[model samples]
Target: MITLNSISKYYETEAGVVSALVNINLSIGESEFISIMGQSGSGKSTLMNIIGCVDRPSKGQYLIDNIDVGTLSDSNRSRLRGKLFGFVFQSYNLLPRLSAIEQVELPLLYQQIDNRKERAIQALISMGLSDRIHHTPNQLSGGEQQRVAIARSLVVNPKIILADEPTGALDTKTGLEVMRIFNELVQKQGISVIIITHESNIAEQTNRIIRISDGKIIEDTDKIVKVKA
Candidate 1:
């Protein structure tokens, strides 16, 4: 569903150009569950941002279902991001004042979707937060808060779920609960999942593990050896 061809990202700092990603190539298929593992400064998050359309690659091509994303206008890219991607961040990124249900409704609100409240409630329920929908972020536990974040992402029915260190803030049991929800989305809904994580145990849960170092892919467990005709 996604392809990156010879992708590179560089920043023009006072010290001169610094490469964040170099000669990266990857393919992610529909319904695939993959983990991107790398240490700090390894460019994993940079790659995720490019994949999710939050940042454009400094060079090379990014194609989503064969459409060249590099060619899209800024407005178009935003629209594409809304249509195709849902994001869950480690920080939860929730508005401090909004209730869980309200947080989940924000995405649909932006899109002007109808029956947004019902949809948001359903998403929260799906994430096992039915009883906590009326609670604000400060009122919930870390895992519950993260579940709210996941609910917000799912309310849009996005094609791909991009999670950046999704379990970084949670305890082990809670993290597993979150991963279980992700697995369900992939198995039952055919949604693709790409998670950025530094934890080996977490990476091993996914169908594929891709390891990056110094901004380059060092290993891909499920990389196809040949291009399909």
Candidate 2:
């Protein structure tokens, strides 16, 4: 459902040009569960941003369902992102003031979808947050806040869920709970999940693991043996 070809990203700083990603070529099939693993500065998040349409690549091609993302205008890219992708972050990224239902309703509001309140409620219910719909982030626990974030992402019914260190803030048990939700999305709902994680145990739970280092793919356990730098 997604493809990256010779993808390279760089940034110019006071020191000099620094590369964030180098020739990243990858393909993710529909409803696939995949993890991008790397240490700090490994470009996994950079790659996720590009895939999520939050950032544009400096070079190479990105195609989603055969459409070249590089050719999209800023408005078009935003539209495509709303239509095709849902994002979850380690920090939850919820509004401190908005209630759980309100937070989930925001995306549908952006899309001008009708019955926003009902849809958001259903999403929260699906995440087992029905009783907490009126609660704000401050009133919820870490695990509950992450579930709220997941509900917010799901309210849009996006084809691909792009999560960055989704389980980072929670304990191991809570992290597993979140992973179970993701697994349900892939297995039952047919939604693609791509997660960026530093935890090996978390990566192992996914069907494929792609390891990156120094801005390049060093190993792809799904397709081949460990690749040398």
Best by lDDT: 2
Please give the CA lDDT of all the candidate structures. Answer: 0.94, 0.94
Model 1: per-residue lDDT, tens digit, 97-147? 999999999989878899998999999999889999899999999999999
TM-score of each: 0.96, 0.97
Q: In model 2, where do residues sit more than 4 Å from their true spots? A: 225-229
The TM-score measured for candidate 1 stands at 0.96
Task: State the weakest 10-residue window (summed lDDT) of model 1.
Answer: 220-229
Worst 10 residues of 2 by lDDT: 220-229
| Candidate 2: tens digits of C-alpha lDDT, residues 11-60 | 99999999999999999888889999999888999999999999999999
TM-score of 2: 0.97
Please give the distance, in angstroms, between residue 138's alpha carbon in candidate 2 and its true position after superposition.
Answer: 0.4
Give all candidate RMSDs, comma-separated.
2.0, 2.5
